[model samples]
Target: MGNYRFILSGGGTGGHIYPAIAIANELKRRYPDAEFLFVGAKDKMEMEKVPNAGYEIEGLWISGLQRKLTWKNMMFPLKLISSLIKAGKIVRRFKPDVAIGTGGFASGPLLQRATKKGVPCLLQEQNSYAGITNKLLADKAKRICVAYDNMEKFFPKEKIVKTGNPVRADLVNLICSKEEALTFFGLDPAKKTVLILGGSLGARRINQLVESKLDFFATHDVQLLWQCGKLYLTDYEKYDSNTVKVKAFLNRMDYAYTAADFIISRAGAGSVSELCLVGKPVVFIPSPNVAEDHQTKNAEALVARDAALMIKEKELDSEFEAKFSGLMKSVQDQERLGGNMKKMALPKATEQIVDEIEKLLK
Candidate 1:
């Protein structure tokens, strides 16, 4: 077997970070002796998460270019220069066989340096619309793994590989019984269950909508396994009822997926992949505060194929309650969405991506 060493760079949100971790796991499964080096923004979530996943990481002093021109923009040039130097140092020392960029600020410097050193570099962009960082790295990226098509608008059409996003393996075949799942969460299996998720860090808009509508849930006999995000507990806790349980995170995500009949979530790429694998009816509230409004675009891609439903963030106040109520009552609609979504799921993408990496190493 060829010596397999990799540098994985990505961070910011779970959308970018989790896919990087999933790819690393696939690499480990394919080549037991493979060594990995993770690169992330110094103060970002990746610093904590990468170590938790059992990988060593180097941090770069990098941050996104601010949307609004604040004092933060003044520090941008200095950070960029320092990060580039740090990236070069890491690449030289590690001498990776391949460098993978999943999508975040840290990826820009690391992938650029790796490509400059003649290492094979791959970039996996999760959104339908390309972000500024990924767009900048596209020219240097030898192959671009993507979840959406028509990306010719962003990257070279020939370099794009539609591998879909990698998801948790347990979610693919969640064969756990409903009774076991409900018991794990201490919920009533006899009642309808709704799972509320707003990405890993949580979306403020979604948490607000769920809190406003909590009292209405009892009317339909739906119990909520509400994941309000650690950031929004103050607002969400005020609405807690016997029928609704609030949590910052769900450790046993398998139980949450297996127990819920319906889900309300942000349309992140990682979440989209997991929802499809779970095969549950979902209502996507795409967070507009995100870059390029890509979440809405991601939801539309599925909605066009009858695989999901989407509601815009601005319209949530006027529409979410009525729309959610109607969907809850329509068993036929739920079944249609679930079936089409499951049909669209790419359960083998994890294996397929690993296979590609193996071929490269061999």
Candidate 2:
């Protein structure tokens, strides 16, 4: 393996950051002598996470434009200019063999500058619906790695590669037993378990629904393993008990997947990919307040294939009980959903994406 220098840029959320990290980790494993530099937006989670993963990272003075009018919007031009200039300097100094972007604010400037400097660039678009930054970079990128099909509508058809989103390596081949997972969580092996996930910041509607329906779960002899997220931990921690296990975060997701007979989650691209691999029946409540309502689109794609179920946020209050109760009552539906989801799992996604990078380097 060559002692190649590589630059990776992505952040703003775990969906983008984790995929970038996964790709970088795979590259590092294969090319142990390689040097890596991660560029992320200042104050974003990646600024903290990348370093902890044993890679050096630089922060750019950049952020996304707010949808609604705000003081921050006024400084967008200045920030963009500053970020571009700094990105150019970084590219010139590092002289990377290749630059990869996983779609985030910082990636826009970094990949743009690197591409201009004649560095081979690749993009990994996790969403079915491409983000503005990735779409803009599509033409310049040597390859566009994506999880979804029919992305030719968004990118140059010739450059698109259907490499699914990179998921956690451990989850690709989960080996934990249900009984052991139940013991780890102090859960009952006999009772059906439903795991709820709302990302690291929590989903307000999901938390509210869980809180209101706690008794319903008990009445039906079902148990809850809810990851309510850090932001809402204090607000929902009071409800944690023997039947209901509410946590801010779950470190051992493999065990959680083993214990869960069903799952309710937000449909971020990364979460969707992981769920498909876990093969648990899931009901996605995609947050409506995202770019292009992309979460809804992601969930709809699975729903179209009968691989999963989804309920929109606005329809939650009127539709939650019926949907939840219907799924709970039918064991056949659970099996069908889980089976279909597993069929969609792309276990080799990480490997295929790195393969594309290696081709570019060669």
Candidate 3:
């Protein structure tokens, strides 16, 4: 039991990669002698992130097919074939007790090969709408763990498990106090502070929206702690001031969540899950450019339940100000939204997913 080996594959975005890491971490804690390896697309973010998380990873020459005709689409067949062969070799070499996929391009080939080799495979789908990768591998997956309900529409009903999405450990148990969080970021606690997140790479339109509203925030006696992402720091850093703190990235999300009176963010599945645990009033601006438009679907699920508010990317110009201003003006709305959102928190998601993985080993 203690010497179990596991292989995990997920990548491209933090949504997929973080869940895989969270699951691996739980497995490591449960089985200290467990060997773990990760497979990811060669040039994707997972290549760097997995190693930084203290796991060995193999990279495959794989990427998703583009909808429109492109050079990458032309290369898909060759890459998929190359990845399948490499994945098969890895599955044979590692001899893992369980294979886990968190739904990404690399996971497509890796988990497919693992299942074909008779390795028990588990898939985690983060969105309300199932990803194409997960759906394609569903028939062979021993279990399909998901964050949203009605996922049976995508996966075999027998294999579907509503385990929710795994969130980072720090976010699950916030240790910082509001005063300390404000002090750490050098912000005044007297003014209402809104934390703006555009994801790890940043959102261009979200950044633009924030820039246009800086004067509006100031007029309302509010301050801003904006995590504009590393990619957009050069473009948006000029707006940094006493009333506005523009950071390239936030290393201390616990502190950021603690200090915020409100939050504005992109509605990536990972962000949505973390926000549920954080339980703050959030305005989700989902990116329209995702697979199946899942980000909007993620936000809408919460919005439908009165757990959060959503403004689509296209409607941001027309709706953001009115929606945001109205929310800001109401304390009861904040409390209600925050309370309902907390009710949706699945803090034990990682542990539960690991429970499924553990069962596979038996």
Candidate 4:
């Protein structure tokens, strides 16, 4: 095999960025001599995150169009034109063997340019509902790798592949023991740990719910290992004590997953996939603010299988405490839910996606 060159374009959120990173890491493992280039939107998190993950990345001048007509929305066409030109230049210079897109606005221009240059492109859609960009690019994609089934509703049936979403390597098979994980987080071994995740930017409703329920959690003799995200960390930090450990982010997710007896998380596709692999009983509080309300649909998929529990944002105030209390009181229910969730995990997702890329390379 020759030294292959690969281009990955995705970003705007961790859901998109992390999957692209995972795929790159797997591809690198298979072809150590291979060169990788990442393209993401300028001023987005991927510019910093992809570099931190040890890769070179180029930024395109692009942003998603806002729903309301505003100054940013007015500039959308100009940005798209600029990004397409820049993306075309990058593709011409890079001459990649294959281009992989993990579903983001940046990937739209880059993959479109790559396809125009006769480069094979693979699109990975993490959500049950396909992204607008992926749907638009589906016609030219050599393959559409997805986490959810029924993607034929969005992409060409012949091109769709259910390879699942790629999660962080550390989360796949947690080597850290529960004891070790507890120590890593400085969490109490005596109390049952309830790990709370509100996404990287934090969810305001989730934060408010957690804050209101602190006393209830204390009463149940459960300790909180909360990742409230950076935006709300300052506001939530004052409540941190022996029972509640609040963090802006959980850099060591392996430890966080291992230490928890149960989890409360937002229902982002990346989070759902990671939680399934972790095999813990989880309560999903999906953000209603997301495009297409896809988060709710993601959670519902798990709930329908009896693999996890979900409380919609609108129902959280009325249903959360009762649902949580019921879950807390039933040890049998926890084990059953955890076992079922594990059965749904596609642990080898990254490897499978790379396998498709390898085929394209040949």
TM-score on alpha carbons, each prediction: 0.96, 0.98, 0.98, 0.97
**Shift in Å, residue 314, candidate 3:** 1.8
Candidate 2's error at 245, in angstroms?
A: 0.9
Over 96-162, each residue of candidate 1 has an lDDT whose tens digit, in order, gives 9999999999999999999999988888888888888899999988888888778889999988888
Q: Give the clashing residue pairs of candidate 1, or none.
A: none
Residue-level lDDT for 209 in candidate 1: 80
lDDT of 4 by residue, 26-120 (tens): 89888899999999999999999999999999999999988899999999999999999999999999999999999889999999999999999
- Candidate order by lDDT, decreasing, is 2, 3, 4, 1
The lDDT values for all models are 0.88, 0.94, 0.93, 0.93
Using lDDT as the yardstick, the better of models 1 and 2 is: 2
lDDT of 3 by residue, 244-289 (tens): 9999999999999999999999888889999999998999999998
Q: Which stretches of candidate 3 lie over 4 Å from their true place?
A: none
